[model samples]
Target chain A: MKGFLLQGKNLSRLRGRLKSALLVRIAVYLLLVDLAFVFAYPFLYMMVTSLKSPQDVRDITVNWLPSGLHWNNYRLSFSLLGYPSALARTVLVVGGCTLGHLFSCSFVGYGFARFSFRGKSLFFLLLLLSIIVPVQTIIVPEYIFFSGAGFLGTYLPMMVPSWLGFGLSGGLFIFIFRLFYISLPRSLEEAAGIDGCGAVSTFFRIALPASRSSVMVCLVLSLVWHWNDYFEPLIYITQQKKYLLPMLLPGLYRIMGGMQDASLSGGDALGDIYTEAVAMAATFLVVLPLLIAYLFLQKKFVQGVERSGITGE
Target chain B: MKLSYSQKRRWSGYVFLLPWLVGAAFFLVYPFVFSIALSVSDLENNNFTKMFFVGLANYKKAFVTDVEFVPKFLTVVTDTLINTPMIVIFAFLTAIMVSRDIKGKGIFRALFFLPVLLGTGFVMQQLQGQSIQSGSLEVARGILLPEKLQAYLGYEITGYITAFFNRITIVMWGSGVQIVIMLAGIQSIAPALYEVARVDGATEWEMFWKITLPMSAPILLLCIVYTIAASFTGSSQVVDYIISLAFGTAVPQFAYSAAMGWIYFLFVLAVILLVFLMMRRPVNRVAQR
Candidate 1:
């Protein structure tokens, strides 16, 4: 009878501990969910608010949920925000930047990794300096230089420097690639060379293939940067038609300001308010490509982070 | 050692390096010199030719004349001092937890790392938008309990608390990169060392302090440098403020903005050099270890 009672006590104690552990886990899960919601809520709010009618949005008691769905807000945002033209401009600029980084940075990084030459140390040091030096300080001089060369207001200023393996900071990728290349066995490159491959051919055939992970990392990073970059696009691309997505979204604020004077005379602030909502919607549209890319390639994205040695640092 | 014809491939190496050398000299060096010169020269006339050297004047103006410079610099410094430690702690803790034999470890790792993919600029813009929206919401909701508690601690203390919150918000959004870096560092550490420590009956706390911290010092240094650089470069608030101050309200003329940027650049350079020197000893020690 005593043994039975002790067994019962032990079972209950075990059950209680298990129950508390389960409770703690659930609490943790809930907390994580709450964090995700907090981080994501503002974006959700922006999207839903963008889809609402002007009246619904401006109602005295704001709707946490949209009263009705409106895809027209997207269409309106496109036209009002000059989405098509700006997106094209953005694609061209970002695409150019990515290609430039891919080809030039790889070639330069390979050189730094494999070569022995006079001024090798000095040149590598120069690359490090380029990474550290703030580009803003040189923006004016570069503007003047490019303008003198009749390259200002063209994609040339944004594109050409990158082609020369310049302007990209966080030399971490290039440095990592160099390290990776150095660590790679030289036997394969020698084998390729013996098969009548030159240095360039060996690079293309052997070195490049081996460094795909690092290259992917550089590509994704460069693309994301160019897509979100506001300052350069704002400075270099003056024409409204030439504006990138980031430049265009902010330009909406300027457009709203311009409309302010005209709207006051019309005695209708509704149009202005609606336009502001549309502008916010346009910002959402600009962000969508990146968001989609992130969703799909998140695994590679994390792998890239790890490979870039950012995690260890 | 006797070098065969294939073994002696010196010329080819240089041939491969030619493009980089040319690019650096033309694109990097020339512009760097020109920029330094531009910072010093007085631009009375429109042409680059019509420039006279005015040593220390721009730096002087940045210090004495510019009201925004001091406050902005202080803001950045305060931000760095606060955010750097929090990020380091958060990243280290997260790495340690994820390294443990926990359920759903991969998922937690992935969730913590998602923000790195959403680049700094996008995150900052999102944060700006959110802050503006939430600021209004807090006012309207009269959610002053947290604020009142903060105030009861006294104004300076409350100010720091608020600043700390703001810095953490920034760091949390920005930490995906740092966390991944720290995770990689933690992962690279040999399991045998931990096993040995466990066999020796070392507590988890002792193992972390004795093994994990020292082994990960190199990466920690790298993170510190990267974080500092990112904070300085990626902050739009600072950039916008600098641009506005330099260009006035109407339009950003190229020359004046350039000059103002040089001032900011010099300040940043000094800070970086100081930090680098301070970090050098730990890095050397790590390398030796």
Candidate 2:
């Protein structure tokens, strides 16, 4: 009787364990869903807030969804913010800078990895230490130096540095490229040489092409970084026409405030709150292109991060 | 021909490195020297030629009389200290979860990483500006417990959570790279060790501490460094404040601003150094074992 009772207890315990396991799984799933929501809510909020009619924006009792989309906010913001010129300059600066990083950083990396140059140790030390220089600390002198040389308000202030391989996070780029090149077998270079490829052509045809993934890594990263570099552009480009996307987005708030929209004068004192919606609309417009680019290049970006950004091994 | 062959290899290296050499001089070395000059001089807005040396006065003024700089800097330093570990641990835990055999892992990974891309240039600026300007600091109030629960936990624990509460967005946004790094670390841990641990009747929890954590020492160190560096350089806290002071409408105090930047940077370096020292023993032990 005692043995049978023990079996019965054991079976009951087994059933209880199974039930708890199922419960735990459900809890995990719920937690993950909540995390996803937390991560996504801001972007979703940005989108919903942007599309709200100015009335819906100020009404405290309104539902989460907008009653009607207000498309005019985008148009008003664009012209007032000088969107066309800002967009052009942003592309020119960011695009040119990314190209410069790819070429300059890779060139340096190839040399460091493949050859024994004079003062290599000193150069290497500088390269390593350069990683730690806070961009803010140098801004004062850099600005003075640039503006003193008749560059400041021009794109040259940013473009020239980028072309020289001294743009933002340039050291990290060089490090990553050097690492990638080092890992590639030295036999490959000898093979290229045996095929009568000169050093320049070998780098161009063999080494460069082999570093396609690293190039993608630098390209995507540099593009995003330069595109969003707020302070460098802020200090350098004072002209409205020279504003980048980051610079222009903030300026749109002023433009929205200046707009003579009839919807803003609802006399509720709370009607002043509609500017929040307009500001969000302006922000959404700024982020839209990058989001589109991200959607398409999502796999490549993540892959690059995995391969080059933080691979510990 | 033999000499030429050997010399060609040496010469080509310098040729390739020329751009970076120029960049180092103009971009790296020059700025560093110029920064020292500015910090030690009574330099003012765009006035390059008429600067006078002021020794450590600007640095001293930052602590003694400049009310805005000292308190603002201390708050930022404290915030960074509290935030970095929380972000690293949270990322590690989340990475473990995502690396499991869960459904829709790809989508979740993408969603989680979206913040990193968004938080970079304009979006980050907008987020900071909006929260500060629009007085939405109460956004994290949703995380508070019921009154009964709070009472049960008492004020101290609850207060700690509340203090950490306001930093939720910064933590979450700052964690994308860390999560990726942690995921890679977890994945890199040898599967054979876990199989052995299981055979030896080890629970998943034990396996984590014994197998996973030890194997991931280097990666964890990397994550800590990355977290500290990213938060220091990326955030618009003290750096932004200094920038504003440097370019404020009244009159730009270049000397004072340079001194302030250097002081803030020292804190960043100190934090990184502290973490590296703390982790070094465990890392060496792990390697030895």
Q: Every model's DockQ, to 2 decimals? A: 0.39, 0.56
In the range A11-77, model 2's lDDT, one tens digit per residue, is: 7986887898788678878877878876776687778877777667667666458888877667755
For model 1 chain A, the run of ten residues with the poorest summed lDDT = A304-313
- Tell me each candidate's TM-score: 0.84, 0.86
lDDT string for model 1 (A141-192, tens) is 6766777889867788778777767755535556656766776778998888
Residue-wise lDDT of candidate 2 within B1-289, one digit each (tens)?
Answer: 3547668889988888899888888778888888888888885445778788989998999999888887777777777788888998889888888877788877888888777666775555556565566443333433445668878889788666655654776687778878876876687566888899899979767988988777778778878887777777765568878888888648877788888888877777787778889999877776576
Steric collisions counted per model: 6, 0
Among all windows of 10 consecutive residues in model 2 chain B, the one with the lowest summed lDDT is B134-143
Per candidate, chain B TM-score? Answer: 0.79, 0.83
**lDDT (CA) per prediction:** 0.67, 0.75
Best by DockQ: 2
Candidate 1 ranges beyond 4 A from true positions:
A1-34, A59-63, A194-196, A254-266, A269-275, A307-313, B1-10, B95-123, B129-163, B236-238, B241-259
Instruction: Score chain A of model 2 by TM-score against the reference chain A.
Output: 0.82
True lDDT of residue A225, candidate 2: 76
- Cα lDDT tens digits, model 1, B183-282, are 7778777789999999997966799898998888777876776776676776545566666644346554434455667766676777777877877886
